[model samples]
Target chain A: MELQEKLKILADSAKYDASCSSSGSNRKSGSGVGNTAIAGICHSFASDGRCISLLKILLTNCCIFDCKYCLNRKSNNIKRAIFTPEEICTLTLNFYRRNYIEGLFLSSGIIKNPDYTMELLIKTIFLLRNKYHFNGYIHAKAIPGASPKLLKKLGLLVDRLSANIELPTENGLKLLAPNKESKNVSQIMEYVKINQSKKYVPAGQSTQMIIGATKETDLQIMSKSANLYNQYHLKRVFYSAYVPINKDNLLPSLEHPPLIRENRLYQADWLLRYYNFKVTDLLDVKNPNFNILIDPKADWALRHLEEFPKEINTCSYNELLKIPGIGVKSARRIISSRRNFTIHLEDLKRMGVVLKRAKYFILCNGKYITNKEFFNKKFIERNVMLEERSLIPTNKEQLRLF
Target chain B: MNNIYIYDGDFISLLNIILYLLKNNLHPENIKTDVYHPSLFENTIYLSILKNEKIIDQIISAFGQYAMRSMYYVFLSKEENKELILYYFFQNALKRRHKIMYYHNLKCVSEVLRISNYVRHETHKMKGFLRFKELEKNILYAEMEPTNNILFLVSCHFVNRLKNEFWVIKDNKRKIISIYDKKQFVIVKEEEFKLSQKESKGEQNIEFLWRIFYKTIGIKERRNERCRMNFMPKKYWKYITEVKEEL
Candidate 1:
């Protein structure tokens, strides 16, 4: 096949792997060439409205394993093509110079077994770094069941590495992608974590969990994601809402991707990462799923009404962050502005706080309250639900899944 | 009297203007910079004796080098009354003992930051969107029309990335060329120099492949033009070759 034809097929197949970030690590060129930006840059957005940061493609679409949820399953009749190392290097360099991408995102479909695919990906990058002297940001996906020595060598060359937790639960992995096992994925993640340093996977490890693939609750998924963070020391746990590309009896056929639920999980994930909230704080046995009507923060605040009416002027930084609309930026602004002058509710808006939800939860001064009835759970929930109606996408289709 | 100081629109000149006004203990309202606009009153006096060495060192030590860079970007802002705003920012910044970076809630401080953030954001976007095509001379050539005069900032990133290659980044709006000849880059105007490009066969093939990849990667089930435009603005769609099909 022509290189262009191969590129089209491989890229189309690789679109299912949705971790497209090219961030975190800053690789220096040392007067050589190509450095990674401290904050990643988005070169373009695909028609799907996803950021095209990396040259995400597959080595080949030919597979030996029959994974029911995948487009490149062995049972599926699809066009397959494998890229030569030289072809990949040429494409990445041209794309980098033209500023088409940050670097390469190379994955495969069990091309001649796991080690062979991993070696091809590593060899392509080694040539890219040593001979071509291309020092751009690279993010490579690890093939499961690959040797530890190969994983170490692979980690040494790339800026960021990922071994996707394709399914949220091990049972989901078994039911859907029977040829694949969750243990192999974790093994690679563990290896990457141990070997990671400035020289190896400097951006650290990140993994993706397919949401709504099998019958997994938001609680189960989040608990799995939180455990991955604590155990693997992950940089990010990307949540990909399962896009029903296959019509198998095993997979749940959906007309639209579960966008609303996916969005709620991300909000809960953010609170887990930044808001210093434990998994238990966000989700309980009674509330197994996030409240789609209101945000996780607002939901938490409404349940714990004693924590409401946090004084904006004298509240601690962490205390202010607990409020629904007050983010890290606005929280810091409140802290600095309070030191100089008496901050009123009017000043809080200018400081970048979203007052729609925060007004119900905070007190600007000791005396002035936004609404006395804000203390009522029913009233607060009604207002938040109204706000969420405006927050929904203009059209029902979501721009991003992760 | 409104004492207007007419100096070159450089960072050092802004510092000189600030220091001159400070030494005279003049209020910020009385001091006006001639760089932006001229006042239509006879009471305005222009002072131009700006070859001072001691003032630069003193200002550097007092404001710190980082704050001086902030002033430079604030000066580049197209916002009206930037001089008066920056004047207030500097006065407040100095009074706070160089804790200006943290004064996010201050109106003047945030105003300076808002402009700098624009400069920073534009530079960051161009870093990823900059496309270099190899011509007949084997020189990598690219063109853009940025909202801000950010050629110096954007080229600094490219110099480190493509140090060994000969390349030129042309700012079509500002009509300036930042040309890098393998080692270092020099900014030249249209009067000084110009480079003509001839499309290479190899370049077309590579772009054809890239366009193919760009088209194939998009999942048709999720097409949100508004979200795409939010990140890769439509204004940039014309220059990005892969996005021309989108046009």
Candidate 2:
């Protein structure tokens, strides 16, 4: 096949894997072609609005496993192409030099088996590192059931290693993808955690799970992600809203991807990582799914009403972060600014605080910024919903006359 | 009438003005650079450029390195009335020591921090958005029109990463170019150095492959042009090869 045709096929197949971050690696260049930045650089953005940080492509689209949720399942009739190690290296080098990409994100189908596919990935990355002296960031997927020796070698070569826990629940995995087991994904995470002393995966490992594919609730997903973070010390857990590409009796057919729900999950994930919120704090038995009208953070604040009207001047950094709109940067700003000057209502606006939502939850100098019914839960909820009304889909049928 | 001092718009010149103001205890009505539009109300005084290195060392010693760095960032910003803002910031920094930066409630302190943050943000964005095309003799050249004077900040990052390669970064907005010779880099005005327009052979082929990869990588079912614009703004789409087709 032609090179362009092969690239098209491989890139199309690999677009579903959502891990695009090139952060956490500060690999310095030593008489090499490139280096990694600590904060990472995004070279471009795809039309889908996803960051095009790396040259995300697969080695080949030929798979031995038939996972029903995947576009590259064995039963699907689609074009398949494999890239030679030389082609992969040339692509990465040219892309990096031209400043089109920060690095390479190489994923592949199980060509013959798990081990063989991993070896192909390793050989390509090893050639890039040794022959071309391309010291840029490289993130590679760890093939489940691959030999430990192969996994270790792959780990040492790349900056980051990821093994996606494809489904939120083990039963979902068993039902949708019978060939794949959650145990294999956990094993890779455990391997990275245990082998940290060897400097394996310097940027650390991350896992991803598909949302809206099965009958799992948001509570279950958060609990699973919390457990994963506690046990494996994973750097991140990506939540991909399921986009149905193949028709199957088991899969849920939807008009659109659950983008709003996916966005809520990401917001909750941020609260977990930065805001120090727990799974139980955000959800309970009665409200398992997030309210589509309001964001996860605001929803949490409304539920815990007694915590409202936090004094901005005297509140701790942790307390400030729990307010609906006070993010990490603004919270830190408030802490530093309050040390020298008394924080007034006007000062909060200058500190980058989102006063639209924060005014309801916080008090400046022990007085409310506005005298609304902040203590009433329903009033606050209605105002927040009004603010987020743009996100709601408008009725096209009513507007047809215009 | 109050006095409004004007000097040549340069970092060292600004530092010298700050030092002179500090030593004399003269609270001028305003301080502006040569680019200032003269007004009939205030008395205008043109200050000569003084070559002094002690002012830099003095500011660094008094305010600490972090403050000096942020002050430099503020100097690089294209904010209007920056000189007056800097004067107020320096006066406050002298009194409050290093803690003045944390006093975000003060108008001058917040303005200084805000302008510095703006410059820093532009520098970081240029690090990602600037696209290098291979020139003749294997020299890489990139052209950008960043909002702030960030050629020096962005070039420093590239010097460490691409240490083995010869490269040039041109800021079209400021008309300055940073040329790296695999060991050291020199920043010169655009008139002092000229770059060839000829591209290296097969550069087009690599760019073509990149465009193809960029086109195919996006999911057809989830195309959100608004979201794409949010991250990579339309203003930056002019130079990026992947989205250049739309331009």
Candidate 3:
């Protein structure tokens, strides 16, 4: 096949993998041709609002394993094209020079075997860095069943690496991706983490978990993510909402992805990492999923109302951040403004804090500003629900499911 | 009454005029003109004075002594509030001392520096955000008329990123234009300029691609209308390749 034809086929096949980000590294060009910008280069945003920087493509679409949900799975008959190491290197350089892409995001199916495919992938990156001197960002996928030594060596060259935990739970993996094991995936992640700490992967590691594919609750998924963050020091844990492309009995037959669920999970994940909220804080066994109506932080604050009315004047930075509507910037502003003078309720309004949600949780000068008569739980819940309904346009299709 | 001073719309010529007016210990009521106006004019000075390169050099030197070479560009760009600059130049010329220009706490000097920084940062960020679409004859056209003198700064980013590509960045508000050759750049006053017929094809394709990409990427379930609107404002949609098609 022609090289352009191969590129089109490979890039199209690889587009479904929602892990195209050129961020998290601070690598600068040292008498080199290309430099990596710290803020990240978002070349384009795909139809799904995901940032596309790299020319994301698979080495080949041919796969040995018949992962039921994947378009490129073994059972699914599709045209496959594989780029040799030299072809891949030349394409990257040409694309980089033309300013079409920032780097290369190369992934592949287990073509022939995992080790053989990984070796080819590693050779392409090696040639790009050493022979071509392409110092721009390169994010290569860690083939799950590849050897530890190959994974370690590849980590040294690439900016970021990801071993996709395609499904949430072991059962999901068994039912959908029968050949893949949850344990093996986690072990690869662990190996990547160990190598990253030893300075092999300077950009750190990230993983993706497909949500709503199986019956796994948000709590279970978040627990796994929390553990991954704590254990491997993963840079990020991306959640992809499963869009059923293949007709499979094992997978849920959905017309569209559970986007709200995906969004809620991101919100919940944000609360965990930045807001200092725990997984348990977001959901318990009874409430294993996020409340779609209110944001995770607001939902938590509403449930734990006794923690409200903390004095903004004297509240520590950490304590101020715990408030639902207040973020790091507002928390810092509250701290800075208070140093100059006693902060009043009106002052907070001017500084751009959400008074409606904040008023329920904070005190301006030893006094709460929430409507005293309408300060009951039912009243607050009704108002919060009203606000949520106004915010989310009530996509009738999504609303129909409930 | 604050009178308006008009120049020939040449930046270097205006700098010389501002210096001459300041050296002669004359303060205009207000500098006003659709023509090129430099900073450091408190009062209006009409373009009655002949263009003098000698006077311009003296002013450039005055700015240079304080390592404020870029300040004159800001001045030429018509960044506001130059009354203190007028006072500083007048004071320094009278005393025959260059130290006054370097003197700290001069409100005009500080304001110019602050605005310069603001303009520079905004221009850099806009470089990343300014979406350019291909036109018919391979002309990359992007329209951004920012509130500040960010045109020159943004051009540098485009020039560096798109080295071999020929592109035009037009400021729709000022009608100022920056055209890039392979290596050189020229800023021209375009009273009325339209995208070439050849360039229109690239624009259409880019618009189509951007719209399709933007629609596909955003997860409907996680749509934060407020956040989305806040980051990508409707006002900017006219310049955005993707959002324009949807509109």
Instruction: Give one digit per residue, the lDDT tens place, for model 3 in B88-137.
Output: 54445445444433322344444554555556655544654576656656
lDDT of 1: 0.81
Error of 2 at A351 (Å): 1.5
- Top-down lDDT ranking: 2, 1, 3
Point out the worst 10-residue segment of candidate 3 chain A by lDDT. A43-52
- Model 1 off-target regions past 4 Å? A367-369, A394-402, B1-4, B27-44, B52-60, B64-66
lDDT of each: 0.81, 0.88, 0.71
The TM-scores, one per candidate, come to 0.94, 0.97, 0.75
Q: Write the per-residue lDDT of candidate 1 for residues B145-208, one digit (tens) a residue.
A: 8888888988898888777788888988878999898779999895677667787668998888
What is the DockQ (computed on Cα atoms) for candidate 2? Answer: 0.83
- In CAPRI terms, model 3 is classed as incorrect
Candidate 2, residues B1-247, lDDT tens digits: the string is 8898887777888878877887799888888877777678888887665668687888888888878888899888888778788888888888898687788878988788788899988888778888989988999989888888898999999998778989999888889999999989999999999778799997899889999999999987778888888889888777888887798
> Any idea what lDDT model 2 has?
0.88
Ranking by TM-score: 2, 1, 3
Worst 10 contiguous positions by lDDT, candidate 2 chain B? B46-55
**Candidate 2 chain A vs. true chain A: TM-score?**
0.96
**lDDT per residue (tens digit) for residues A236-310 in model 1:** 998877889988888887777776788888898899898888889988788888876678889999999877778
TM-score, predicted candidate 2 vs. hidden true structure = 0.97
| DockQ, 0 to 1 scale, candidate 3 | 0.13
